[model samples]
Target: MRPVDEHVAHAVSLMAPVDLDEVALAEAFGRVLARTVTARYDSPRFDNSAMDGYAVRAAEVTVGTRMRVAADIPAGSGEPPALHSGTCARIMTGAPVPHGADAVIPVEHTDAATAEVTFYQSAVTGAHIRRAGEDARAGDAVVAAGQLLGAWQLSAAASAGHATVAVRRRPVVAVLATGDELVDPGMEPGPGQIVDSNSTLLSMLVTAVGGVPVVLPRCPDRPGAVAAALAGVDADLIVTAGGASVGAYDPVKADLAGHGVEFFAVAMQPGKPQGLGTVNGIPIACLPGNPVSVAVTFHVVVGPMLRALLGAVEPKVLAAPAAEGWKCPAGRAQFVPAVVESDGSVRPATGGGSRSHLVASLAAGRVLAVVPAEVEQVYAGDTVGIMTSILENMG
Candidate 1:
């Protein structure tokens, strides 16, 4: 049997980062930047007012000093006339400060008169002013390459004068669920049958990791079904659940065995049956049948692959104290769907710990509590490594 880390590394090796493409800033959210974004112009663009007040020369202003409001300067107004002595500009926030104006007294600190404003407080030079390039300078790197574009990153990119950015294209993932005993969700399952929840689970997981999920038609256990459904399909990766085990009815193992897909007994509980290879030039990953196994394998193997394709770094594993104790599978690594509490302690999401078929527990799980193969038990308050979901860490 292969070690868990070996399988994860092998699976990720099958994927390559997608090509870089220029996309509009509006459509670049959640995408990874392929190139470093530099500032086109100085941040703040120009010397502007940080507050709605009168722009004045500090040396000329004192308590009770009345100055003539020479001009009104609202935002976007171009180049007001230079301020002469004993004169001030009524400047709104974000308005460019007039030349020779070194200070701004907020409106609250003066009489609310526009034409002839009276200041009750003294002015300080450079107060309430946003100097050009204060935040960043032109040609400075604003957003580094490989950074995921989010609201804040996008805002910075736009503020740096970028209308479009070069980012890695999102990967298109094809998801297929196999099992003769499975039916589509919402339909009542007959005796000895179950709903095909793995499809929905895999699809949602794929999307959460920044991949476009194309849910393929469900495949049965019959010969050639898995291969036929995958024929002529176009995708960056193919993920299939079920039929990779050593069962007589495992079609995924049967059909794709000699065609480059290698099945392995990974040293991990609930997700030991793993298959990874290419089918028709598209990388395919076959996970175990159970829903919990699907979730675990997605985090351990598939999520990293999708992240790699997007030029995204894998999420850092956090170490937190276990809120309770649990047993682990001997000689096989365990990934228990668990929740990290607000107090930074971790606990199982369900009472049935590490059960592969506990589908409902997945909804409550925020992270996967990873245990080494040699560790047989986790006592209360013992520190454990956790792999958080990508959705939880997205900004």
Candidate 2:
């Protein structure tokens, strides 16, 4: 049996970040940046008032002293008349500060008037003034290469004056689920048949990592049929569910054997059956039929490849303490669906055993607590590696 990391490394060696393309800022969400984004102009662009107030000099009227209003400056006004001695400019929020004005006095601090305004207190220089380049300067690097652009990053890029961004093209993943006993949802099954959920699960998983998922129809266990289904699929990666393990009615591994596919058992529980090969010059990753196995293998092996193909970084894991004690399998590494408590303690989310076929147990947790192969027994307060179920925790 091969280690999980070794299989992931081999998968990554066959692929890299897709070509770069310019996409509109609206469409660039969740895409990895292909180049550094520099600021086109300084933030605030010019000195402006941060509040709706009067722009005036420090030598202006003291407490209860009335000063003549020289000009009215609203936002987007090209320029304003310079501040004359003993005069102030009526300015609105976000409007440029008039020349010779050193500070802003809020409208509330001035008496309501048209021609003249009375200040309740002396003005301080540079108060409530948003200076040019205070937030970010022109030509400064705002967004770095290889960074995934999300809502915050997109907002920052927009603030930097970017209408579009160069980002890595998303890889297309073909998801095919196998098993003659599998039937689509909302259909009545006769005798021994189950609904096909792995296809949609894998497709959603593929899309979670920014890859475009192309889900194909379910393939039967026949070798010829599986071979025909595997042929001529246009995708960067082909992911197949079922027929990967050593079973009597499984032909996914045998059908692709001639195409350089190698099926093996991973040194991990739940997802022991794993396969990798190239079919029609496209890389195919075979995962087990069980829903839980599909999820575990996809996150451990396929998630890394997706990250590598998108020029993204590896997921970060936290060593959280366990809230309860449990014995683990002797030889294989175990991954149990668990939730972190408010106290940051990890506990099994499922009220059942850690069986691969227990599909419903997968949704009981937000993270997967990992127990190494050597850990035969765990005690309360013991630390275990954590893998979050959500995409936000991946990076």
Best by TM-score: 1
lDDT for each of the candidates? 0.91, 0.85
lDDT of 2 by residue, 43-122 (tens): 97999999998999987657888988989999988887788888888999999998899999999987856589888988
Encode model 1's per-residue lDDT on 289-376: one tens digit a residue: 9999998999899988887898886778879899999999899988888988889999999999988999888889988898889999
What's the residue-level lDDT of 44 in candidate 1? 80
Which portions of model 2 miss their true places by more than 4 Å? 58-67, 108-115, 118-125, 318-327, 340-346, 371-383, 390-395
How well does candidate 1 score on lDDT at residue 256? 95
What does the lDDT come to for candidate 2?
Answer: 0.85
In TM-score terms, candidate 2 sits at 0.86
Residue 73, candidate 1: Cα error in Å is 1.7
Candidate 1 runs further than 4 Å off:
60-65, 393-395
Find the candidate with the highest lDDT and give its number. 1
